[model samples]
Target chain A: MSGLLDVEGLVTRFYTEEGVVKAVDGNSFRLEEDEALGVVGESGSGKTVTALSIMRLIEAPGRIEAGRILFRGEDLLKKSEREMRRIRGKDLSMVFQDSLSSLNPTLTVGAQIARVLKHHTRLSRRARWRRAVELLAAVGIPEPAKRASHYPHQLSGGMRQRALIAMAISCNPKLLILDEPTTALDVTIEAQIFELIGELKEEFGMGVFLITHDLSVVASFCSRVIIMYAGKIVEEAGVHELYAHPLHPYTRGLLRSIPPLEGGEARLQSIPGEVPDLINLPPGCNFSPRCALADERCWQVEPELSGITPGHRAACWRAERPAMAGGGHD
Target chain B: MIVFLSKRLLLAIPTLLVASFLIFSLVHIAPGDPIQVMLGDFQDPELIARLRHEMGLDLPLLQQYFHWLGNIVRGDLGISITVQRGASVTDLILQRFAVTVELAFFSLIIALLIAIPTGIISALRQNKLSDHLSRIIALLGVSIPNFFLGILLILFVGVYLRKPWGAGGYVPLSRGLLKNLAHMFLPAVALGTAYAAIIMRMMRSAMLDAMSQDFVRTARAMGIAPADIVRRDIVKNALIPVVTVIGNSIGYLLGGSIVTETVFRLPGMGNLVIMGVFRRDFPVIQAVVLIIVVVRIAVNLIVDLTYGFLDPRIRYGGER
Candidate 1:
């Protein structure tokens, strides 16, 4: 009957030479129990930083300057480093990007997985070993019992990602954050990963936070979609509704940018102007500079996330009702 | 692997030849002759000529180098002029070289004891008071010459502890391990303290670098205990660079121990070389230098092989 995670007014900034760069500026969202939310954005939209801030993995010069991240109603920002560490594995886990670099190169897959078990469970050595093998098998690695004994280098990109997944889900965490989960793999492996996630999500009803730039993935698996721009959520709605009727200019632009495959020409449309620099940003709206329908009001006023319908929001001054058909201006 | 060895081997030939050339030239070019130093108080010019002729001092420079190289290849480094019926330079080195090895072994042990924990703590608490304190300690070690530190340690041990500095002679490690260890501690520590500082600083930097790697974050996300992260994740990855520093430290220790030995009044290889330098004993100096070079090379090769064990990503010949 309630949300598994509730992040509100989350503002993260990096103290740099020029000025504070608001990496995640007053962004907020939530995931209900057993829900999967996809975050789609261009680079510098604070996609990764938002995920990192939730995990309390922000390093020096960069820190959560304001806001609350409530996991199961416990304020995560107030937790001690040690406490946050415990929550990271036991409650919320992350399947990191770049499995080649994410997996410890020195340790075997089994040893790496065993470490997760060791952290959250008080299992004996034998129990940990068996559990590591079982987790590896669950992730669909071939000869898992033996494969777990091999180091990260011995595995291909897909296998390394599976090992990362095995480690992430080891504790049956309430939430799993997959940052660009299938972005590094080929189509077949990507399909395997989507299917594996489906299987695991069914087995353990953990909420999923999928962060990627791929719009297709949101269409495929996400229950809800949150579109971000310049470190702020511009639009949020159910996956079906958002794709069919993206109200925010940025979201509409992104949807139209995906090229089609066929005999016809595939030239896609794109929004002009790069993402606004977080440091020394122009005052009012960040996306206003690139907006097509910008007015004096758009440049002078900061648009807050406002509901256009129940459970749907868009931070746009000129948002209109979506057409009944798939998203289009006609 | 063979290619690497061949490369190392080809590189070593030039290195060894350059060393041989320098030692041979400096000894010959210097004003005083070894014959004069050996037959001191001899104003007789005829005896000097006879001795110089017998030792092949009359040969041209290039001829002498080839002759020496040929003999060295045949395992006959020229006989020691100082010691009567002077043993082959290699044999004399082998006998005395063990003492230096034993001392270096103790130094490495002492260095490890001081470095590993200090470095790990420094990196784990990076930029905190303890980390600053460790940095200060390392800086002081780097700033102050080891010879000054050596002298200070000897004085501290003598004026305060009331332990005799050079009264007990050397005890062979094989005959009595405990006695040998106790006897070597003061000198070894004097030599090892600098190495410890070096290794500690290198390890701290390496661990700091490793700590920032993605897998380290991955390990943290796995909720691995801080201690386990330091041990299994941080240290394991950090070890490669540390090994390189320590391998290089071996050369520093053996080369620098000469001054420390002089300060402590010990009869180690350093002291022996200093004595040979005063007496102008070319054979003993060459033998000592050669032994130091070979031992350093051995340590480096051992370090290279160790890299294979430390990181699976590093293979001897790399991946096919």
Candidate 2:
């Protein structure tokens, strides 16, 4: 079956005065319906840019140079802005990271939710408000009626996030793109938010495009994962497969960086060196500067994402070597 | 809210007292003598002394201040010294204040009507030709003096066009609303243009800030119509800061109306105060200045209250 979202050879760039920043260089991924697919990367790794490209929300200074985002087998790029407007909140919705800033300060949380319903649904004003309050309650907010009248600042961080989620899911979108949705929340709230999203995915049967820097978050919440580096995907595999046998050296570094649950003398390992500047990236693989296993060939030529074990892929020339198959963990 | 309001009102008392004291002392210290101006070329020392005694100007400065303060507290603004001898300063102010209030009110309306839409458009289409045009217009509005603009308006609309309502004059509201508006419109435009420029630039920057905020992105991502996003997300949030600018500018508007009123030949507080200053009408000057200070205080209070209304995070006196 065709996937719910298929991004093909996407290249998004920002034309700044400095240079053209290849924010999301040529990369592609697919997300199945009702499946949770996580995009893992450190900051400036083009994960957010990929999601924005799909949403077609890239503004001036940034342009989707070349891409085909197929949603439900229809080319979204081919759709008119007016048609895209109808499809956006109804068929696709996005929840941003900063809940407080993501919600309008001047409007009550419910009124903001009702606004989405106002455009997407034919519900009456009163009915939209009622539905908004209902959505709030469904998102686990207490005293839905009273909370509906409260502005975003009046609510706690978790509650505000819940309000944002309620707004995103108000129209019952088929695909929900959550960009670092729990990054601003505490650990406990983060777990609860993911749990809520998991439940909502099942309830709504919505495919989730979960983007985060945290490997553990994807490990817990996503069934399939794609690890991105700089502006390209470095690895793609099933959650268990990726965790047990991460093919890419960058992915291995990420997996090793996750602190073990049982506290021991093992210090958390960090991937050394910063994300490369997109405007002036080094020759060969973007990760070569930081990869310990990077050889002469790795510095001279970039590698394409090639299948290793069936269903597992990595864009590393060294991944095919038998000695590296064990997936280093110390 | 009530507690906050009452506290602010109580604070105004001390402020008004200080302002009144300053006005009284300054007027008394100034070289011009109302009696001398009133009895021009007469050279009657005995009459001047008797008149000064009757007016209680011969009393000690502190005594005079206390006496005037006492009368002010009792809602008595005293009699005009020379501008209109024996006429109640309170009555004179009341008559002239009506005209100024109308002028200021209409000017504000004109200002908002011009500033808001243009501000939104300018911000929405930033760096575009329309935006550039609006910015140029706003710059002109700011750069050109109101009196000079007033003269240009008179030259264009009054002399060149030869329209009956184009010339400088005041029409009482009692005559008719349209006639009153027509007479007030040009002066209002003259006074308002500068404020419009100020408010427009404020609104433009504020809108730009609002547009770049995360909430606006969320609104757009939700597929809310572009118009709706602009209205609800951008404009609504943008108005908060712009309201503050508008509130602060109201004081400027009232002050600016002085020149605007003079140019337009309107019998407003500006004209009254000018006459008072020239004649050294102490009571008239003191009362008019006092009223202005009070009006400014009241406007500031209103602005503060509006903050709570605009942004829900602002709760007066910590009330939920």
Q: List each candidate's DockQ score.
A: 0.61, 0.83
| True-vs-predicted CA distance for residue A329, candidate 1, Å | 6.6
Q: How closely does chain A match the true chain A in each prediction, as TM-score?
A: 0.95, 0.97
- CA lDDT of every candidate: 0.84, 0.93
CAPRI band for model 2: high
Model 1 agreement with the true structure over B78-101: per-residue lDDT tens digits? 787865346676776666666777
**What's model 2's lDDT at A45?**
93
lDDT tens per residue, model 2, B93-141: 9899999999999989999999999999999999999999999999999
Model 1 interface DockQ = 0.61
Candidate 2 per-residue lDDT over residues A103-208, each given as its tens digit: 9999999999999999999999999999999999999999999999999999999999999999999999999999999988999999999999999999999999
Collision pairs in model 1:
none
Colliding pairs, model 2: none
Stretches of candidate 1 off by over 4 Å are A78-83, A262-266, A322-330, B1-31, B41-43, B83-95, B166-180, B317-320
